[model samples]
Target: MDRAEFLNRLEAQLLDVPQAEREEALQYYEDYLNDAGDAGDFDILQELGTPEEVADSIRNGLRQDSSAAGERSGQADEN
Candidate 1:
């Protein structure tokens, strides 16, 4: 798929995520694609995998970050 289609699919998959996070992810990918001027859409897709895969990665990363932040906050509270 092309960049637009890939981003659309990713946005659809990210519907359950918060708006700010979703937008940030989309913008990050958009910038990534723009920076890859030498690569074609297929190449980028191949490197990144499908939108579902990318969205899952983003979600997983967010979950890990959130968990870490919560743990830090809890430790601070206990101190």
Candidate 2:
């Protein structure tokens, strides 16, 4: 799919996400796409995967990071 279509799909998928997090994710992908387009590669979606897949990857990363942070904090509390 094209950039607009991919972004539209991503936005729709993000409808249930918290506003701040949603905007951050959207901006990250928008910048990523824009940079790719600027570098003369317009069909970046193929390389990036579908919006749903991208969102799932991002959410997974967020969950992992949060869990790691919690573990770190818990260890700190034992000091």
Candidate 3:
């Protein structure tokens, strides 16, 4: 997808994340695009993967963090 389409899809998927975190993610992607653009790397999109895939990865990471936090809380309760 092109830059505009990529950003639009990314913003939609990031709706559930905190604003600051979402902005940080967006900024990182934006910088990646800029660097790729300067380096004549039009195929960077292929390496980054699809927006849906990236979003799913982010969601999975969040789920893992939540599960870990819950486990830690349970251990604290037992202590």
Candidate 4:
């Protein structure tokens, strides 16, 4: 997918995430793409997996963090 489409899909996937975090992630990726473009890497879009794959990876990380926090809280309650 092209730059616009990639970013669009990413934003949509991030709907469930907080607005601040979502914007931060989007900015980071935008910077990444800009840097790659500066380096003449026009194929960066192809290199970065499809937007959906990237979003899934991000969502998985969020889920893992939430799970870990929940486990920690549960343990604390039991103590």
Candidate 5:
């Protein structure tokens, strides 16, 4: 699929993510597509996988980040 279609699909799948995080992810992918288009040698979907896959990856990353932040806060509380 094309860039617009890919982004649309990604946005829909990211509904559970917070607004700021969702928008940031979309903007990052839009810029990535623009950069790749200029290169003329990159297949973004192939590189990044489908929107479902991308959403899952983003969710997993967010979970890891949240977990790390929680750990840090817990450590700070102990100090």
Candidate 6:
């Protein structure tokens, strides 16, 4: 899909997320597209997978990072 359509759908899908988080996530994808465009790698879209899949992966990564950070915080508290 075109950028506008992709973004509209992405925004709709991420409506449940906090506005700041959703904007950050959308910015990341926009930057990804910009980088790929600069590198002449339009095919990156196909390889990077579907938008929903990409969003899911991002959410998983964020969750993992948050979990790790919480663990680290807990460890620090114990020390």
- lDDT of all predictions: 0.93, 0.83, 0.80, 0.83, 0.91, 0.75
- Stretches > 4 Å off in candidate 5: 38-42
Compute each candidate's TM-score over C-alphas. 0.93, 0.84, 0.75, 0.75, 0.92, 0.76
- Order the candidates by TM-score, highest first — what do you get? 1, 5, 2, 6, 4, 3
- Candidate 4 residue-wise lDDT at 54: 81
As a whole number from 0 to 100, the lDDT of residue 20 in candidate 4 is 79
**Model 3: which ten-residue window has the lowest total lDDT?**
38-47
In terms of lDDT, the poorest run of 10 residues in model 1 is 36-45
Task: Give per-residue CA lDDT, model 6, range 1-79, as digits (tens).
Answer: 6655666777777777678888998998778777767454447666766677777776777789899999999999999
lDDT of 3 at 13: 90
Q: Which number leads on TM-score?
A: 1
Which residue runs of candidate 3 sit more than 4 Å off their true CA positions? none
Candidate 5 Cα lDDT to native = 0.91
lDDT of 4 by residue, 1-79 (tens): 5677889999998998889778988898898898777554457877778878888887888789899999999999999
Candidate 2 per-residue lDDT, tens place, 1-79, comes to 6787888899888787778888999998888888776554455777788889988887787789889999999999999
How many residue pairs clash per model?
0, 0, 0, 0, 0, 0
User: Comparing 3 and 5 by TM-score, which wins?
Assistant: 5
RMSD of each: 1.1, 1.9, 2.1, 2.1, 1.6, 2.4
Q: Is candidate 4 or candidate 5 better by TM-score?
A: 5
Per-residue C-alpha lDDT of model 3 across residues 1-79, encoded as one tens digit per residue? 6876887898899899878777888888888888778454458877877777777777788789899999999999999
The superposed Cα distance between candidate 5 and the true structure at residue 16, in angstroms, equals: 0.4
How far off is model 1, as Cα RMSD?
1.1
How many backbone overlaps does candidate 1 show? 0
Of 3 and 6, the candidate ranking higher by TM-score: 6
Question: For model 5, how does the per-residue alpha-carbon lDDT over 1-79 read when each residue is reduced to its tens digit?
Answer: 7788889999999999999999999999999888888444247677898999999999999999999999999999999
Number of the candidate with higher lDDT, 1 or 5: 1
